[model samples]
Target chain A: MSGRKLIALWLFVVSVVVALMGFWFMATRASMDYWVMAGSLILISITCYLSGVHHYLTTKNRHGRYIILYGSVVLMVAGLSIYIPDVLDLRPWEIYTRIPSDFFFSFFMLIIGILSSYVSFRPFHNFTKEGAQSGAYYIIHLSIIFTLFPLFLIMFNIITRGMGGITWEFLTEDIVSMGEKGGVYPAILGTLAMISLTAIIVLPLGVGTAIYLAEYARKGLAVRVIRTAVNILQGTPSIVHGLFGYAFFVLILFNGQKCLLAGALTLAILTLPIVTRSAEEALNAVPGELRDASLALGATKWQTIKKVVIPPSMPGILTGTVLGIGRAAGETAPIMFTAVYFSGTGTPSGLLRPIMALPYHLLSLYRLVGYRDVEPQAWATALLLLIIVLGINLSAIIVREKYRQRF
Target chain B: MINKVLELLKEEKACQRISLPPGIKAKTSGFSLWYGSTKALKDINIEIKENKVTAIIGPSGCGKSTLLRCFNRMNDTIVSVRTEGNIWLDGYDIYDDVTDCVDIRRKVGMVFQKPNPFPFSIANNIYYGCQVNDMDVEKDEVVERCLKQAALWEEVKDRLSENALSLSGGQQQRLCIARALAIEPEVILMDEPCSALDPIATAKIEDLIHELKKDYTVVIVTHNMQQAARVSDYTAYMYLGELIEFGKTKQIFEKPREENTEKYITGRFG
Candidate 1:
C-alpha cells in the first residue's frame, strides 16, 4: 500500500475511536485522565504536521492549505501555553495550572481526527476523477450525519423528558386547576374536531382553485395574478392569519365571540395556499396527453377532468390536503385568538362554542409552570401534539406510496 | 410557389381518370391555422373518403398533424391556436357556431403519436370512452370487441385487470386505438401512430389501419413514405404549411405529378 493510503487508514481508525470515546464521555460524564489529555495533545500536533505536509504535497492553491496553517498555529499556541509558567520561572501559587476538561479533550480529539482523515484520504499531488468522487462521497456522508444529528437529539430530548407524564388517566381526563392536575382528553378531542373541520373547509376551496389553475385557466394576467396571490398567502405568517381570523371571523362575523368555526376558518385560510399549490402540482403531473386523449374520445372538458384528470391526481391531492391538515393540527397561534379556551370548555359541543385545544392548553400550562405544578402536563401536551401531527404526516406518506401512479 | 401548387391541383382535377370510391366523410375548404403569430397551415383543402385510408405525408413541421387535428377539432384545446376556415363532417359544417365540438369529436376519434392510456386497468381503458360517452352497452362485450379490433385481445385478454401502463409501447398504442374504437366513431385520425414504435410494431399498426378502413374512414399522418404507400389509398403531400399534391397513393408514388411531390416520394428531398 502507498504511504498515503496507510495514513488514511490510521486516520479513519483514530477518528472512529475518538468519536466513540466522545459519545461515551458525553453519556457517562466521566472525567478524562491527565495522561489521556497529554497523549491526545501529542496526537493532535502530529496530525497537524502530517496535514500540513499533505497540504503542501497536494496543491499550493487549495482551501486545505489555510486549514492546515490555522491548525498548526493553534497547536503551537496550546503548546506554548503549557510551558509559559515554567519558562517564566513562576511558582505554582503565582501561576494557575489549567486542567483540560473531558469535553474539551473530546472536542479537540474530534477536530484533529477530522482534519487528519480529510487530509489523508485526499489525493497527494494530482487530481483524478476517482479522487474527486471519493472526496465528494466523504463530504456528502458527513453532511448527512450532521443533518440527522439534530433530529435525533430533539427526539431523544422529547421522549426522555415527556415519557413520564403519559398515563392512561392523563390521556383520558380533563385539565384541573390551570392544567396542574387533570388529563387532556377534551383538548385532544377539540384539536381533532378543529383540524377535521379545517380539512373539510379547505379541501373543496383548495382543490377547486388548483383545478381551475391547472386545467382551465389560460396563461395570462389573471392566472399570473392569482398565482402571485397564492404565493403571497403562503409566505404570510401564521400569526397574521390568526389576527385576521380574530378581526374578521370573530369581531365582524361572530360579533366578537371566539368560536370553533372561527378557529377552523383561520386554519383553513392558513393552509389553503399549501393545499392549492400541491394539488395544482399533482394535477399538472397528470400528463397533457391523457387530457388530449380524453378530449379526442369525445369527453367534454368537465367530464375529462372528472374521470381522466382527477383519478390519477387523487393521491397527490389527498397527500397535500392531509399535510396541510397536519400543519393545522399543531398550529397554536391561528387558534389562540380565534377559537381555543385555556380551560372550562370540556369538549367541542358545537361549531359556535370555543373549546380547549392541545397547543393552546400547552401554552397555558407553560405559562403556569412556576406558579403552579403543570410542567409535566405541558411536556405531555407537547408530546401529544407532536404525535398527532406526525401521525397525519405518516398517513399522507402511506397514501401517496399506495396510490402513486407511474405516468 | 402558390401558383405552381394551384396548377398541379388543376391538372390533377382535370385528368381524374382513376375512379375513386364514392362518399366524402370529411372535407376542409380554405382552411388555415395559426399558433399565436406563427401560421401553421395555409389554405388546406382535401376530401377524406368514407371507409378509405387517407394518409397525410410531410416532413416535420409541415402541418400534416395540424390538418388532421382540424378534422376532429382537437386543436381547439390549445389556447393560443386560432383557425380561419370551415371543416365539414358528413356534409355538415362542423366549424359552424351552432356545432358542438363534443359531437364532432365523437364522430372523429384520434390516436396520438405517443400512446397515452389512462392510469387504469386494460379493460377500463377500453371502457373509458364508452363510459364517458354514456353508451349503454355491456362492459365485457365492448372491451372484447374493441381489443379484438385493435388486435390486442389475445395478448392481454387474460390480464385485463392489470394496469394499461404495464403493456409494451406497441401494446399501449394499440390499447389507445382500442380505446378510440370503443367510442364507435365514424372517422379515426392517427397522427404519426407508428413513429414511436419498432419496425414490427409499425407494420402491425399499418396492417391495423388497413383493416380499420373497411369500417371507419382512416386519416393518418406519417413521416415515413413507405408506410404511407403501403396503407393509404389516397395520399396528401404537404410542405411548409401548403398542400403540394393530393391524389391516389399509387400514382403519387409511381408517376410524376408535381416536381415537388416526385422529389419528396423519390427520396430526392423532403
Candidate 2:
C-alpha cells in the first residue's frame, strides 16, 4: 500500500529466503555450518518485520497474523535446537564444556538484539510509541547481558577451579607440609573463635553508639563531631587498621603477643561505624508518632528506646553487622599483623595464643607459587572463605527475621 | 443517620444529667509554655472536673494541644522548652522538684490523633502499659477489662496474637485507647483523636470517649467544634495561644461568650 510497507514486505521475504538457504546449507553442506548462525540473525529480523506489518495491517486491532508468524518462528527454533542446530557453535552441552564458548554466547546475543531492535523500530505508517520504544528495548537487552557476564564468568571460573581441592579429609585435618597438603581445620577454628569474640565486642558498643546518635543525641556540635569522626574511621584503609592494631594492642595492651583478642578487637573497631550508621538509619525510621505514643503511655526515654525503637531496628543493625563480618572474614592484613600464625598448636587453646586463620592460610599458600600443587589449594581456600562469609550472612538474616517487627 | 442522631442526642442528655464531681481532677494556673524564644501557650488557667469530659477546641497551633500536653507534663520530653506555671494533677503540683514526670505520665494516659500501635501482637500492645509499669493486675484481667472498656475486646478477642498493625485504622485507634486504659490512669488526654478517622470510626471513638468519662477525667483537643459539643460537658475555646472562653458546652455553643469564640464556631476566621 505504501513505499515503507513494500520495503518491509521485501525485507521479510529476503530474511525467510536467507534462513531457508542457510538451513539447506547446514543439512547438506555440513562443512558450512556457519551459515546456520547467520540464519538465526535473519530469523530475529522476522520478529521485528512481522511486528511492523502486524501494526500496519491491524492499526488498532489485534495482530493475529503477526502473532501466528512469531509463534511459528519461535517453535521452529525450538524444533531445530533439538536437532542440535549449532547456531554460533552452541553445540550439545556434552561436547562444549571444554570449549571457550563465552565469546560465541555473547556474540549470538548481540546479533539477535540488533536484529530485533531493527524490526521493533519500524513504524506502521508513521512514528508511534512502539517505534520510539524499540531503541530502549535494545539498550536494555545489551545492558543485561553486559551486567551478567562478569558475574557468570567469575562464578564459573571459581567453581570449576576450586571444587577439585575439596574433600572430607581436607576440611578436618591440620596443616602438615608448611601449608600445602592438609585440611584448614585450625584456620577454620581460629576464624570462628575470633569472629565470635568480635561479635560480642561490637554489638553492645555499636548498638549503644547508634542509639545515642539516632535517638538520644541532640543535633548539636557534639553529634556533628562524632559523625565526622565515624566517617574518618571508615575511610581509613584496612592495612592502617592492622598497623594500629600492631602498635596499640600487640605492643601496648598485650605486651607484644599476637593473640586472637587483639585481632578480634581490631575487627570490632573497623566495623563499629558501619554498624552504628546503618543502625542509626533504622532507628530513625521508627515513626515519631510511635515514640509519642510510647511516651504518652509513660515509658521514659530509655524505656521507649529499649522497647519501641530498638526492636524494630534490629534487622538493620544485624545487616550492617553481617556486612562488617563479611569484610572481616576476607581480610588477611588485620589478622596477619595481629594474630595468625603459619601453623597452630591445638586450636590456639585460648584467645591469648596465636592461631591460623583461612585468609592468612591462603596468603601462605600464595608465597609457595613455585609449587603447582598449591594453586588449586588456593582456589579452594578462596571458595571456602566465600562460603564461610555467605553462611554467616545467611544465619544473620535468619536471626534478624526472627526478631523483625512487621511494621 | 436518623438513628445515630437520636442515639447521640440520648447520649448527650445522659452526659448532661449525670452530675460531675465538683472536685478538680487537674488544673493549670498561670501556665505559660515556650519553645525556645517562641511562646506556645500564654498565661492560661483551666479547671478539669473529676469524671467529666472537657473538650479544648481551636484552630491548628492555637496552643490547645500545648495545654493538653501540660496536664500530663508530656511537654517535658521536648528539648529547650520552658514552662512557667503550676500544674496540679490529683492534688499534686506535678512540676515541683519532688514530682517525677514518669510517675506523672503513668497516672495520666494519652491517646494521640493518629493511631500509634507498636508493631507487636494485639495482646502485647494492649498490655504493654501494664507490663512496663510492672502493675500488680493479672495480665488476663487487664487485657479483658481494658479492651472491653475501649469497646474493642469482642472484635479482637480471637486474634490477640496477630500483629497490631494488621487491624483497621479505627481498630488501631481503639487499641491505643485500650493501651492507655490498661495502665488504669486517673486522667486520659486525647489530642484530636478522631481527625485521622472516617466518619464511622469517628463515631465509634466519640462513643468510647463518652463511656470513658465516667471513670476517668477526659481532656480532648479537637478542631471539630461539633465533636466538642457532642462529647464534652465543658468546652475551652483557645485562639493564638490564649484562652478565648471557657464555659459549659451548651452555653458556649448557643450563647455568646466571646466574639472570637462565636466567629470560630460559626465558620468565620479560624
Tell me the TM-score of each prediction against the true structure.
0.85, 0.78
Alpha-carbon shift of residue A94 in model 1 (angstroms): 39
Fill in the DockQ of model 2. 0.51
Error of 1 at A237 (Å): 1.3
What fraction of the reference structure's interface contacts does model 1 contain? 0.94
lDDT of 2 by residue, A304-352 (tens): 9989988888888888788778778888888788988766444767889
What's model 1's lDDT at A166? 93
The candidate that wins on DockQ is 1
- What's the CA error at residue A100 for candidate 1, in Å? 19
Which whole-number lDDT from 0 to 100 does residue A348 have in model 1?
90
Per-residue lDDT, model 2, residue A228, is: 96
RMSD for each model, in Å, please?
Answer: 8.8, 12.8
User: Candidate 2 has which clashing residue pairs, if any?
Assistant: A48-A119
User: What are the runs in model 1 whose C-alpha is more than 4 Å off?
Assistant: A9-120, A124-127, B1-22
